[model samples]
Target: MDKQIETELEAAAFRGLLTHLQNHPEVQNIELMILADFCRNCLAKWYAEAAKERGIDIDYEQARDKVYGMPYAEWKDKYQLTATPEQMAAYEKRQKEKQ
Candidate 1:
């Protein structure tokens, strides 16, 4: 595939992922981290890094807003659930495994 076509395809895939995440608020960030070693926050950080690489001055919060489809605080208030003890333990285990 041409470079432009490949880029467009990747962009479309990213958009589809974002839409899926937005539609599934119950899939908490911690859960994503536990399952995939990354989460929406990771995505936001990557987004910000990419913008920086492109000479665009997008900050973390701005990237987060784009990924969350709203302000992070508002999204947290609306849908983010507190991690349970089990989840925390699992997360810790995952962290250790990463080391």
Candidate 2:
């Protein structure tokens, strides 16, 4: 495929992922960190970086709001759950494995 078409397809896929994540509020960021080593926060950071690369000014919080479909604090208050012991252990193990 050409570059333009490829970029559009990639953008569409990203939107789909964002929509899926928004629909699944039960999927905690910690769980994403443990399993995929990235979460919505990471996506927000990446989004910010991309904006910077294109000479756009987007802060992390702004990018996070776009990713979360709301302010991060509000989303956290509404959807974030305390991690279980098992989840913590897995997260720790994943961190260790990364280093």
Candidate 3:
């Protein structure tokens, strides 16, 4: 495939993934990071970095709102649940192993 076409396809796939994530608010970021080493915040950071590379202005909060489908605080208040001690421990263990 041509490079431009590949980039477009990747962008489309990323949009689809973002849409899926927005619809699955029950999936916590910690769980995602623990398992996949990336999550919504990671996506937002990537977006901001990409924008910077292109000389576009994309702030972290704006990028987060895009991935989250709303302000992060609103989403957290409405959908985020407190993690159990076991979940926290698992996340920490995974992070340590990742280091």
Candidate 4:
């Protein structure tokens, strides 16, 4: 594919993934980290980095909003739950295994 077409396809795939994630807030970030090695916060960091690379002025909260489909605080208040000790332990084990 041409470079522009490739970029557009890539952007579309990203948007689809973002939309899926937005619709599935029940999927906890820690679960994503344990399973996929990254989560919405990782996406936000990458988004901020990409914006910086492109000389765009996007901060972490803006990037997070893009990923969360709302302000981070609102999302946190609504959907984010405290991880149980067992969940945290499993995530830590997964991270160690990855390393």
Candidate 5:
């Protein structure tokens, strides 16, 4: 495929992923970290970094709002759950394995 088509397809895929995540608030960030080694926050950071590379100035918070479909604080208050000890242990083990 050509570059433009590739870019459009990738952008569509990203939007789909963001929508899926926004709809599935029960999937905690910690679980994402343990299973995929990345989370919504990581996506926000990457979004910010990508904007910077393109000479845009999207800050982290702005990127987060876009990825999360709401302010991070509001999302946390409404959806984020306290991690269980088992979840924490799994996350820690994943971190160790990555090293």
Candidate 6:
């Protein structure tokens, strides 16, 4: 594929992923981290880094809003659930395994 075509395809796939995440608010960030080792925050950080690579100045919060479909605080208030003890334990186990 041509470079431009490849880039457009990649962008389309990313948008699809973002849309899927937005439609599935029940899939908590902790769950994503535990299962996939990356979450919305991770995506936001990556997005900000990409912006920096392109000589753009996008902060974490701005990237997060783009990912979360709202301000981080508002998203947390509206959709974030408290992780249970079991969830925390699983997360810790996953972190340990990564190290």
RMSD of each: 0.5, 0.6, 0.7, 0.8, 0.4, 0.6
Each model's lDDT comes to 0.97, 0.97, 0.94, 0.96, 0.98, 0.96
User: How large an RMSD does model 5 have?
Assistant: 0.4
Error of 3 at 7 (Å): 0.9
Instruction: List TM-score per model, in order.
Output: 0.98, 0.97, 0.96, 0.96, 0.99, 0.98
Q: Which stretches of model 6 miss by more than 4 angstroms?
A: none
Candidate 1 lDDT over residue span 1-88, tens digit each: 9999999999999999999999999999999999999999999999999999999999999999999999999999999999999999
In candidate 2, which residue ranges exceed 4 Å CA deviation?
none
Location of the lowest summed lDDT over 10 successive residues in candidate 3: 79-88
Candidate 3, residues 1-99, lDDT tens digits: the string is 999999999999999999999999999998998889999999999999999999999999999999999999999999888998988999999989978
Q: List the residue pairs that clash in candidate 6.
A: none
**Which residue ranges in model 5 land beyond 4 Å of their true spot?**
none
- Position 70, candidate 6: lDDT: 85
Q: Per-residue lDDT for 1-99 in model 5, tens only? A: 899999999999999999999999999999999999999999999999999999998999999999999999999999999999999999999889989
The alpha-carbon lDDT assigned to residue 3 of candidate 1 equals 100
Positional deviation of 14 in candidate 3, in angstroms? 0.2
Local lDDT at 52 for model 5: 98
Residues 10-96 of candidate 4: C-alpha lDDT, one tens digit per residue: 999999999999999999999898789899999999999999999999999999999999999999999999998988998999978
Candidate 5, residue 37: how far the Cα is off, in Å: 0.5
Measured by lDDT, the strongest candidate is: 5
